[model samples]
Target: MDQIKARTIEIFLPTGDSKEVSQAIITNESIKIIYISKSEIENQKKRISKIQGCYILVGKDDDGSDLAYIGQTEDFFQRLNLHKKEKEFWDGVYVIQNSSDSFDQAHLNFLEKLMIQEAKKVKNYKLENVKDGNNFSISESKENECYLYFSTIKTLLKTLGFDLFVPNVEEFEINEENKFYFKEKNNNFSGEAIFENDKLIVLKNSIVSNEENVKDNYIQYLKFRNKLINEGVIQKNNENLIFIKDYPFNSPSVAAGVISLKSKNGWEVWKNIEGESLDKKYRQK
Candidate 1:
C-alpha cells in the first residue's frame, strides 16, 4: 500500500473560538487530539480530566521563540493541574488520546519517548523535557500501531500551526527552477533564496549589507533585521552579515529587502539565472 494516502480530518471548536478548546480527529481513526488553552482549562476539566494519553505543552519564550513540553499521563486533568502551578511558560496543551481508552501505560510510555525524540530532531521548539521518557516493552504488533498513532499526532499538531516535526531546510531538495538571487555589486550585497512551500527561504551563507544601508523609514524591517542578528540567525563576518542557517520569510519582497538593506519590490529584484524577474516568471500568468 502507498504510504501517502489521502485522509479526512474533522475538527470541533467547543468554544466557537478556534484558539480556545478544539478537538481534531482523522476520519475512521481512534486517536484524538484536544487543544486546550490555559485560560480554558477550567471549562474543559470535566471533559478531559479522566483521559489517558500523551500531551504537549506549547508556549513562547522571552524572545518569542517557540517552546514545548511533551509528556504522558493516566489522568489528563491531574497532570495539567500540576503544570498549571509549576510550569509558567506554557499557555496551551495538546492532548493525544485514544477514543476507546485502548492505550495502557506501556503504550503511553512508548509514544512519549517517540515524540520527544522527533521533537528534539526537528529543533523547531525549545523542549522542556530534560530526559526522554523510559523505554517500555510492548508487543511487536502494538509497537507498529503506536507508529501509526504518532503519524496522526504529527499531522494534527501541524494543522494547529505547530510544525514540531517538520524537516529542517537542509533536508529540502534544492530545485534550481525555484531558486532566486539578489545581488548589488557596489553595496557588497549578495543572497541566494528559494521560493518553496509558499515561503521564501534565504539560504545559509548568503551575504547581506550593513544595517546602515537600510531605508531609514522602514523601521519594522530594520527592527526585524536587528532581531535576527541579536538572535544569532545572522552574524557579522568581516565586512558583511551572513545567514548562519536557512531562514524563511513570508514574501520575496521581505527577503529581498532584508538582503539589500533597502526597500525593494522583491518580485522585480529577485531574478533567476537568466535574469528573469520573479514577477515575470511566477506572477505574469
Candidate 2:
C-alpha cells in the first residue's frame, strides 16, 4: 500500500517534456509531512477554471493562533485528499473549507509580506529570521510614478505613531474623509522629517539621507545631537552643524554618543574645510 501511494505522489506534478519536480517521501513508521505553496494552488485553480485559496482555521493562539498550515495548490480537493492519505495529522489541512471567494491572491501576497515583517517586531517573534530593511536599490525617483499616489501614507502614518492601516494605499486621496494630506508627487524626501498632520514623510526616506537603519530613534538622535553641539568638535552654520576636524563616528546614535560631546550629522560634523560638514559634503555631486 505504501509503495502504491508513493508511486501516486511521484506521478502528480507533470514535467515540461523533461523537467521533474521533487517531493518528500517518508519511510519511517512514525510520521512525515510535506508542504506546498499557495501560488501553486492558485495556478492550478486557474488552469481548471475555478476559485481557490481559502483556509478553515481550526483554532487560534493567545498572540495569534493557528495549528493549520498555510498552503496553496491547483486541485484543492485532490491535494487535501492526498494529505489525508499520507500525513499523520490529517485534521490540520483536510478539515479546512474554502472561505476566500473574492480574495486577490496577488494583493494577499503583499499583505502576507507586511504581516510577516511587522510580526517580527514583536517580542515573541524577535528571533524570526526576517531581515531588517529599506535598502538603497529602492529608487526614490520612481516612488512617485510607480505607486498609488498616497500609497506610502500609512507607512508614513505608522512612523508618526498614528493609527492608519487601510490595506489599500490608493483610496486615501479619492475619499475626502481620509483627512491626511494628499501631497501627490510633491514631497521633501531628503530634509528633516518635518512632522505634519497632513504630510507624513520618512526622514530617512529622503534621497539625501543614507536610508536609516530600522532601530534608530529620532528622540535619541536629538538628545545625542544636542550633546555634540555643546562639546565643540562640531558647530553649526545656521540650522545645520559644521565640523572643524575629521570626525570618526559611525551611526547617528554612536556619533551622537561619542564625538567630543558635540556631534552633528557626522557627515556634516567632521570635515577638513572650514564650516563644511562631512554629512553633506561626503555625498557625490
Candidate 3:
C-alpha cells in the first residue's frame, strides 16, 4: 500500500455509538489486509452467563486464520477503551460479541496463555506494564510510540521477544500520612489524604523533594483550616489573616501560589499543630 493512501475508520464509543472518520492504512499489494478490533481481542459477557470476565479475542489476521489475540479482563469495556485510546488503526472490524460466552479464572489463565502464543506467532506490540496497571507497551517511549505504528509493532515483534508490559499513563496509590511543605510548581499533585487524630495529613507526597515538614497552604488548605477553626482546630484572630492559638506559623514560598485567586500571605497561609506561624510560634516556644 502507498504511504499516502487515504484511510477511513468508523469509531465506536463505549455507548455503542459510532462515527466514521478518516485514518491511514499502510498498504502494499504484497501485504494482505488483516482486521481485528482490540476490544474483540479481549473478553465479553452475555446476559445469562453467571461467570463474568473478559475473553481473549480469537480471530484471524492477514498472516493466517485462527491467529488469536489473547487477553484477560474483568471489565471488557474498560480494556476495550484502553485499546481504542491507545490504538486507532483496526480496520474492517465488525463490532459483534461472540454468542454464549462466560469467563472465569481458569478461562483467564488459558486466555493469557493463548495471548502469549499469539504474541509469539505474530509481530505485535507487547502489553508491557499490564501488571502495574494495564499498561500495554508496543514501543519504548514517546519517540518509539511515534516510530512503532501498528505496522512497526508487528515488525518489532518479529525482531524482539514478545513482552507488552510497558508502563502506561496511570497513577499509583501511595497510602501514608505525612506533613508536606509545598512550593510553587503549578503542578496539581493529587494523592490520598489521611486524617490523624485531630489533624489532617496527605498520604506521601509523590513528586517534588521534601520529607514533609510543612506545606505552603492554599485557600483550600485555609478553608480546611477554617473548618477546623470553627470546630476548634485553631483559634482565629480578628486580623485579615487568621492566626493560630498563639503557636508560630510557617509561611508559604516568597511568591505565593493562588495570589490571583485570592489575596493571601505566605506567613498566614501556613499553620502548625499548635496553629501558629513561625513568627508567633517561635515566641510561644
Candidate 4:
C-alpha cells in the first residue's frame, strides 16, 4: 500500500472572522479556494472579479435540503453578480482558482464537468443546474492535472465545512464484523447496514416497511421517511419501500427507525450474522 503523506493547509480569514469570507491554500500548491457569502459579494468584487475559475453556489431548497449550482467562468465577480440577481437559492459560493492565473477556459470547463459528475455521484445536495456541463476534449495530461486540482478542491471544501463533494459512504475495505442486519418477519422488512466511521449506512435495495407503524406523535422519523420518498431516495415497490441507493444515518436507531417505520432501539435491533446485537458487539467491548 502507498503511504499518504501529510500536507499543510493554511486558511486566512479576511474579515478576521472564521465565518466570513476566507481563503485556503495548500503548501506549495497553485490551487486556491475562496469562500464568499452572497452578502459579501459587493465587498469582494475588487479582489476576485477577474479571476478565471470554477465556482459552486450552495444553499438550501424550500424543504431545507442542501442545494447547489456549479459553473465555470472567466469573470468571477460578473458571473456571481448575475447569479445574485437571477438565482435566489444560493446563499454562498466557493470559488476555485489558480494563483498563477494559468487556468484557461478549457481547464475550467473540464473542472466544472468533473465536479458536477462527482457531486451527482455523492448525491449530498440537490443540484440547481438542470443540465451537466459540456464534455469538451482535453489532452490526457491536462485531464490528469484537472483531476488533481479537483482532489484539492474537494479536500478544502470539506475543511471549510462544506461537504457537497464528499461521498456519503466512502469506499473502504468491508468485512463481516462491520456489517449488521435488521429483519422484521411480520412486516416483510429486511435491511442490510454497515457501521462505518460511527455512521450506520443502510445499503441500497434494502426493503423497508411502507407504512408508518408508530403511534408516537413526537417522533420525526415519519417526516424524514417522507422526505426520502419525495427525494426519490426510496420508492415503493409492490407493498414495501426500497432504498434506491445507500443512505447514511447519524445513528443506528435512526437507520432502524427509517427502515422499520417505527421507533426502535437500534442497538438492540441491529444484529450480526451470529445474531449478536450492535450493543453487544460494539458497546459491550
Candidate 5:
C-alpha cells in the first residue's frame, strides 16, 4: 500500500474547545485545513473566504451514518455562505485550501472529483452531492500534484478525528493464523471473520441473518445491520443477506452481535478453526 510519511502538524484552536473551531497546518505543505462549526462559519468567514480550494460540508443523517457534500470554489467563503442558507444536513465544514493560492477552478474541480470518488469507495460517509462531479483535463504532472495534495488532505482529516478514508479491512494483508469464525446453525447466518487494528472485519461472502434473532433487545445491533445494508456492506443475493464486501465493525462484539442479532460476548462467540475461543486466546496472552 502507498503511504504518507508522518510529519509535524501545527494546530490552532482559535475558539479553544468552546466552539470546536480549529485549523491544522502541515509543515512544508501548502494545504491548510479549517474545521469549523456551522454556527461559527460566519465568525471565520473573512479568514476562510480569502482561500481558494475544496470544502466538505459534513454531518450525519437521521440514521447516524456520516454524510458530506464536497465542493470547491475560488472564493471559499462565498460558497460556504451559500451552503449555510441552502443546506441543513451539515453541522460542520472542513475547508481544504492551498496557502499559495495555486489551485484554480480547474484544479479544484479535479480535486473535488477525486475526493468524491474516494468518499464513495470508503463508504464511510453518505455523500449528499450528486455523483456528477465534473472532471477537467490536466497534464500528468498536474494530476500527480493534485493526488499528492489529496493524500495530504486525508492525513489532515484523520488528525482532526475524521477518518473518511480508512483503509478497507479486506485490503489489509491479514495473516491466516489471525482468522476467526462465528457460526450459527440457523438457516440464515454463519461467517468467518478477523479482528485487526481495532476493526472487526467480517470476511466477504459471510452470511448474515436477514432477520434479528438475538435473545436480548439489542437495538444497536439491528440498527447497525440496517446501516450496513444502506451502505451496501450487506446485500441480498436472492433471499439471504450476504456480505458483498468485507465490512469493518467498531469492535468484535459489535461484529458478533450483528451476525448473531443479539447481545453476544464476542470473546466466546468468535473462535478459530480448532474451536479455540478468543476468551482463551486473550487469557493466554
Candidate 6:
C-alpha cells in the first residue's frame, strides 16, 4: 500500500516513434511484456512468433467499457495471429514471458488464472473469456514463483499506463479531512467524493437522479446513462438511480453533471463537510 517505488523500465521502440508497436522490458525481472498494435503485428510477426508466454488482448466495447482476454500459450505470436483472424475486438496486446525462458506450461497456466481472477475483481474491464480459463494446478514452489512474477508484471503494466488493478485509496494519499459532498435542490440527488492524485472518485452507494425526467435533447447524456446501467455502475431500483460502486470522473463538474442529469459546475456543487465549496478550495490552493 506504500507509494510505488522508483524502478527502471526500458522500452524498445522498434519503429522509432511508434508507441503502439514497442516492447517494454523491465530488467532484473522474470517476465518480458511487449505491447503491439494489430496494425503493426504483421511486420513484427517473425520476432514475436519465436517467443511464447501469457498474453492479454486489450480493447474497448461498444459501450466504451474496457475489455480484456488473458491467455497462455507455447507459441505466443502464432496464437495472436489466429486471434487476428477469429477475434476482431482487440487493438493491442501485452505479451508476458520469462526472460530466462525458464517458465514452463505450469508457470504460464498459473499466471493466466491469477490474471483472469484479478481482472474480474477489478470490474473496471469487461473480460472476453466468459467461463473461467484453464484451472490447472501447479507445484507449490512454482505457484509462489509465478505469483512473484505476476506482481512484477502488474507493476510493469501499470508503468506502461494500463492500470488494470485499482489500489485502495490509502495507498495514494491520506487526506480524509476534506471529504467533498454534493446535493441537488430539486431532487433527492446526493453523493460523496474524495481525491486521489488529481482525479476525484465519487464514493459507492451515492444517489443520482433518475434519467426518466431528463430532456430528450440530451442524447449523449442519455446514452451515457444507459452505459452506466449496463456496466452495473448505476442501479435503478424502486424508481431511484444509485451508484452501486465507487466511480471516478475526470473533474468535479463531470461528476456533478452525471448525478444532476444536467450540465453543472462541479466546483460550485461539491462542498466540504464545513460547507466550503470546491471553488473556494481551489482558490485556497
- Per-candidate local distance difference test: 0.85, 0.31, 0.32, 0.86, 0.82, 0.79
Q: Which window of ten consecutive residues has the lowest lDDT sum in model 5?
A: 167-176
TM-scores of the candidates are 0.81, 0.20, 0.21, 0.91, 0.90, 0.91
The digit string of per-residue lDDT tens for model 1 on 97-123 reads: 999889988789899999999987766
Provide the global lDDT of candidate 5 against the true structure. 0.82
| Tens digit per residue, CA lDDT, model 4, 1-285 | 333667889999998876669889988889999999999999998878888899999998899888899999999999999998999998899999999888987788889988888888888888887878986889898989998998899888988888888776668555676778999767768998888778888888898777765667525878888888877788998787899888889889988887877878999999999999989988899
The prediction achieving the highest lDDT against the true structure is: 4
Tens digit per residue, CA lDDT, model 2, 148-210: 212332332233222223221222332222211111134211122211232322221112211
Q: Write the per-residue lDDT of candidate 5 for residues 1-285, one digit (tens) a residue.
A: 334565889888998863469888898999999899998888887788667889899988887778899988878778888887898888998899998888877678789999989888877778888874895688888889998898889988988888777656745676667888888764568878887776678888898777854445787788888888997888998878888877777678888888867778887889987788877766567
lDDT of 3 by residue, 37-110 (tens): 44333332232123234333333334232233345555555555565576443321222121233323443344
lDDT of 1: 0.85
Model 4 lDDT, full chain set? 0.86
Question: Which stretches of candidate 2 lie above 4 Å from their native place?
Answer: 1-50, 56-66, 90-101, 111-285
lDDT by residue (tens digit), candidate 6, 22-134: 67777666677888888778887776887879998999887668888889888877898899998888999888878789988888788888888987777777888976677
Ranking by lDDT: 4, 1, 5, 6, 3, 2
